[model samples]
Target: MLQQETALQKLWSWLFENKVMLLFLLICVGGVAVSGNSASFVIENVAIRFGRNAFTVMSLLIPVLAGLGLNFSIVIGAVAAQMGLFFAVDWGFNGVMGMLIAFLIATPLAMLFGFGVGRLFNKMKGSEMIAGLILGYFADGLYQLFFLYILGGVLPVKTESLIIPGGIGIKNTIDLTGNMKYALDEVKLVDIVLIFFIIIAVISVFRIIIKLKNKEQSPLKDLIILLLAAAVYALTYVPAVESMLMTSKLSLLNVFLIIAVVGIAYAIWKIISNKLNPDPKFKAIRYITIIVAIVLLYALTYIPELEKILMNSKVSALPLALIAGLSLFNAAFLSTRIGQNMRTVGQSRVIANASGINVDRVRVLAMIISTVLASWGQLIYLQNLGTFATYGAHLQVGQFAIAALLIGGASVSKATNKQAITGVILFHTLFIVAPEAGKVLFNNAMLGEYFRVFVSYGVIALALAMHAWQRKKKPSLELPA
Candidate 1:
């Protein structure tokens, strides 16, 4: 019975890990049945509407990577994007040109915002997650001030369409239809731009890290890992009787990224492997296996049916870049030697000083990274949404993003990309279906809204309480031991 229970526990953990996929499946089935009366319309409408939402959802993955929590302040990025849109409107840069210009403008703003937020977070140290959540609220107030009081009055907001009726500030919502709608719809194919950029970025970063580590660390094991990964990517990109173009074209940039990543990994592996005297043959097997695994990884994307369903969908390249970039930020915070130093400084400046790490410098860098990711995420999210919420736009952004992440199973001290993605999917799915589901089952859509609010708050409370409880229990457990 104990063994059975243990097995069940393991199964439960696995389920938790894959909760998003499970929830997605359940929602699809239940959604279909619930709306079966108009299944076709529901499918067509929901897919189109939600597809527009994918980029924002994907944006949440970045701060999670950077170990900055869920980045509820990503709305800062959105605000930056909105500022761009506003400017584009002023300049009469219509359509794609306007959208492109907005994107360009948002980039610097995002970076600036990210740098500031990152700095603040470093100061807060252990409390970065909660700090970020609160920061979102503060930023929202600023956003509202700009949108409400400044834009039309102090700043030049020329277009009546964008301005409010009284003419002091911008309208509650700007009509994005003619301005920036589907600007990149053509030149930015879901395939070439989005996938290519992601693959290239991921591969290059991974390779560079591995290579750098190899120079100072171990070699054979790292080499094996790189080779195996290369094999996987190579295999996936290989053309059959059909042309290579027919296959998933691995972009040159992606190839570069992959090389950089493998290089870095190799360097790291060699260093680690050298510290432990393992059999030389074990090292050889390891490299072979590493190459094979990477090859397999890239190859996995080649399945015709799966690729058709997943890869064929058009997505923006910007979000992918943001995710990759933010993840590196998180990686820096979490696992890196520098990251450990940051934590040390956060815990005790005196001790960090004693340990010989530059606490002040580390703190600054941490802030810069966090804020930059925040800025970028906000931009991606706003662009993806193609609209702004005005006073309430950035208000609960930090809260909701943090709540969603925790609900999806991240604790304050530890979060991962997987958790952020899962949380966003589940949280958004609930956002979509709950009201309707409530209306269908309970007779009032508002009930679903209430349920959502309850769950959102409940998750945050639960996560915080859990953290406190664990902290309290640690002393007791250690005392007995």
Candidate 2:
């Protein structure tokens, strides 16, 4: 009996240690097994579907890192992305050009809205997440007013097709396939841009590891890392590399390979140069060169493609995922940082004041950022669906983003980029497949939608419960007498 109990304890300890990987593996296996005979088809279909969804999921990364609690305001970015799509479609902007133009158009709106949300979250402090969540709901009402009523009645939307048959209101749904459909995926421009972002993330991780390796060392390693990063950017953007990318299959794998080679070469070059002479002034020049090179390369690659596509495609209600992802990331990160500061102020405004951090500034920033992310999120969502359902479209965004984040393993007080991505993938996978999974077993597709909703909400509840349980487990030491 004693031996059995000891073995059971050991098993429990092992499971706890490998919990995240174990859970992820379980989800993958369970998802596949549920597909039964069509599992391969189902897996591939879902994975491709995931690519369609990845941009939006990635949008939540910055906000989570900044501690903003899922940026419920991502709807704002979505909405702004929609406006760009709407105009692009109206003007007959096709494919890659439309995507780029739409992205450019959405940027200003995302910044404005994100700033507003950041301010609001800053005011709420400890309740930033909940505050942002509610704010998203309020913004939805405003979004509906603009999208459903104002645009057709007073705003003079140029395209007749966008307005309703009544001629005084917008339609319940607008088809956007003609303008901005699959712009990002279809555009075969510099594969390095995609790889650049991924490599930046990798280099970021490597820098962290290096920091841990030599905490006692001088700040020289940072300069080396920065120089390497810049070199990678410069090498990847060299005009000659663009031709090579053009010949290769325009796939994510190809993009990744190019980025890996560029990063390796850049790292080696920087390491050798730093060993030869470590000057801060030279380091700054390297940084500037990398930034300029990347900018020039991106412009050289996408500008022409965008110009050509802007002349062709037209989609009214399109999903501008590419643009929204970038905007939301910035907004979420800013708001999260401001909100964290606000929490510190809330814990003791006097101490925070003494430290010279302006509480009001933090609050304002939080509000702005949150609002911007929300705006972009709405835009991306509307464009992707290719239509808007009057009252129903924006209604679920706050709940969905929040629910998705929590489902992915986020909490009210803390979250991470990995959690946001993992949650969205799993949540979306379940969302995409649940209906079919249900139909196969129960012969009813509606059951699948209900199952998805139930699971989404259930996941949030589970995360909250787990967080509370974890908090309870922390032993409190009595104050010394």
Candidate 3:
């Protein structure tokens, strides 16, 4: 009976820990079913939405790490990107060049905006989240003022398309068709692969040199990884492979197979390396779990409906690659010195200060990095969308991103790249199907739209409430009188 009670408690803990994710998963499944959308259609929409919004969502991570909850001020970064886009379009730049110019223009402006936000956050230390939320609104007002009065009115601007009828403010909407539409998405997958290969090669070589300089063990593992990467890059040049990549879309089955192969290869490499090195950190259970997951995924592909969807659904490669790169960046950043400092400060500003760390500077740096990334993320979002809503594009960015992050099981004091990516997938999946699900269930599409919007805000509020409740429940350190 004691053992049974312990087991039940453990199960309860597990359920409590994963309640949000499980709830979202159930909703996604039910919504997809009720929406009456084909599996392929849902997958396609989810993939596209993921590509469009994942980066912007990711831009919230750094500030969260620095103890600034949610970084709602990232909307300022979005506004800066829009400003850059406006000037880029006004200057007659097009294609990738326009995107590049916009990025260059936005980077400095975002840095400036981020600095101010950081200073403000520092002043309002414990209340950074609320401060950021208010800051976003304040920034939006300034953004409107600039676009409405400063652009064509105070400044000399002859761009007819951008100017309003009264010729005082910028137009409410700016079309990016022919200019920067699909600019990054249109990049050849082969080129992206080659660039990734080269970066990996360079990093590998650098690490190998450092190892040799220190007279440490041979970098056999690095060499093997580089070789594997090179082989993958080489396959891209094969006529059949190249043709498949050049096509606008790729089969989800092929994509899944590729992922499975990569996973298997990694497992094999880990096993071999473990046998050779006998690392104490190796976990048999973890590998077993991974192997089981891979097998289950492959088995699911055999189901007739799932198989049809997997074979029929296609996804673009470049945007996915970009998202993967950003995810990697987030992971790698945490291993660096600044990331360590940010983590230290996040855990305890007093301790961090006692450790000789400049908490304010670190927080400022975090905001700058987040703000710049947010600017770039907004650019990616707009280019794919091919339309810039001058006055409104940046409005919901902070709220929606924060909501997604919170929905993915992240909290005020802790977040991870995995959580961010999971949140993007789950949150966007709900966004994609919720309206249709609502319509089917309630006979009103507007209800679904309202439901999704509500879920976004509701999730954030729930997470905040939970955080407060947890804090309140924690045992105090004071001794009894």
Candidate 4:
């Protein structure tokens, strides 16, 4: 019986590790059933949403890495972004400049907000999650006060449109139509594909360099590299592939901004950052897998059955570049000195302390980083939406972001970039189909809305419960006896 129980436990652990994939499969089935022939439309929406929400979800990674739980105070970061947008509007900054200026104004403010939140988290320690949630609400009140009264009443305001009719408070909705709407998604597909191709080549070269440094070689890696080279050659000759690549693009300014913020900046940082000393064989395997994927993507473009479904559908705001950058950052950050410290702090604060690791400082830095990322993420989201809700936009920010992370298979104790990405795709796919499904099944779309909210909050609660249960099951480790 004891052996059987131990075997069952191992099975459960394996299943939980792949929980994100399982959840995605279930969501995909429900999506197809509910949307029926409209599945493409649902897919389109998910693609667009991926650009909007993924960054915020990604922000939760650092804090979780440091075992500080989710950073509920990221809502404060969203608020900082909002404040920047407001000021940008007042300055009459339009188009690309408007969004850029907003981000510029928000960065410092977000850093300031993050610093305070980090300090507070350090003080609270074990109660960080509950405290952070409460802190968000408290900050919300101050945010309301600042926008509602302080801006128009005390601070000098130049823009009449930003104020309510009474000229005493900020308006309930600020239109961003004149500038900043779909600002980052305005490029032609040809231009976008050119960028993607460049990315593929760079990634391929980077992998080769890493392998050379490690003095590792694999037959599979050699095979995939050859295939990618073939794909690159094929792409050079294929007009149809070029045409498909131009399907979605942001404006020139948005393009420049994205390249700067999500591309060049990320590249510069990665170059400076130390990589994890992964096993040479593991590193070889990782690069080989990626190279195979590149080869497969190029191959997929030719297969008639999949070409239309995969390449020709035309997703307008996928923000593939930004996604790549964030994924890269998350993956690479894990191998740094700080990243290792985060793991140490996460596993056992006592051990970390004995190892001379400053657990509290690491946790604070994690919160600050999460806060800054969340702020920038909200900026990305609003640019796509082309408008801002003056009062309640940030209200559900923390809840939704947290829910998406948890649904992705992230728990209080563990998460990864892949899990975060998977969760956003599944949760948002479900979000897209649930209303229509609810309408079709129950004759009311509101049922779907409520259900979505319920699922979001429910996922968070379930994750917390599972974490507690796992803790109870895994007895504490004993020191060398």
TM-score of each: 0.63, 0.65, 0.88, 0.76
Local accuracy of candidate 2 as per-residue lDDT tens digits, 1-481:
2233466666765554334434644754675567463543444444454444544555554455444555666666666666666666656676667666776787777777777777666667567667766776787778778777777688777778777787666676666676654444444434535555566657666776677688865546665666676776566577787565453223323333344556456756775687699865556456446645655654543556443432233221123234334545554644665555656654566777888888666545544544454554554455445555655665566566666666666665555556665666666666656666666667677776786777667766666676576557433311223
Q: Tell me the TM-score of model 3.
A: 0.88
The full ranking of all candidates by lDDT, starting with the best, is 3, 4, 1, 2
Winning model by lDDT: 3
For each of the candidates, the C-alpha root-mean-square deviation to the true structure, in angstroms, is 8.2, 11.6, 3.8, 8.5
The 10-residue segment of model 3 with minimum total lDDT is 472-481
Candidate 2 positional error at 127, Å? 3.2
Q: What is candidate 1's local distance difference test score?
A: 0.58
lDDT of 3 by residue, 326-372 (tens): 88788888889988999999999999999999999999999999999
Where does candidate 4 have its weakest 10-residue lDDT segment?
Answer: 250-259
What are the per-residue Cα lDDT tens digits for candidate 4 across 81-159? 9999889889888766787799899989998888888888888878989998999999999999999899989997899
lDDT tens string, model 1, 69-101?
455666666667667767876778866677668
Q: For this target, which candidate reaches the highest TM-score against the unseen true structure? A: 3
Candidate 1 residue spans exceeding 4 A from truth = 1-75, 94-97, 114-135, 184-187, 190-340, 343-351, 470-481
Ranking by TM-score: 3, 4, 2, 1
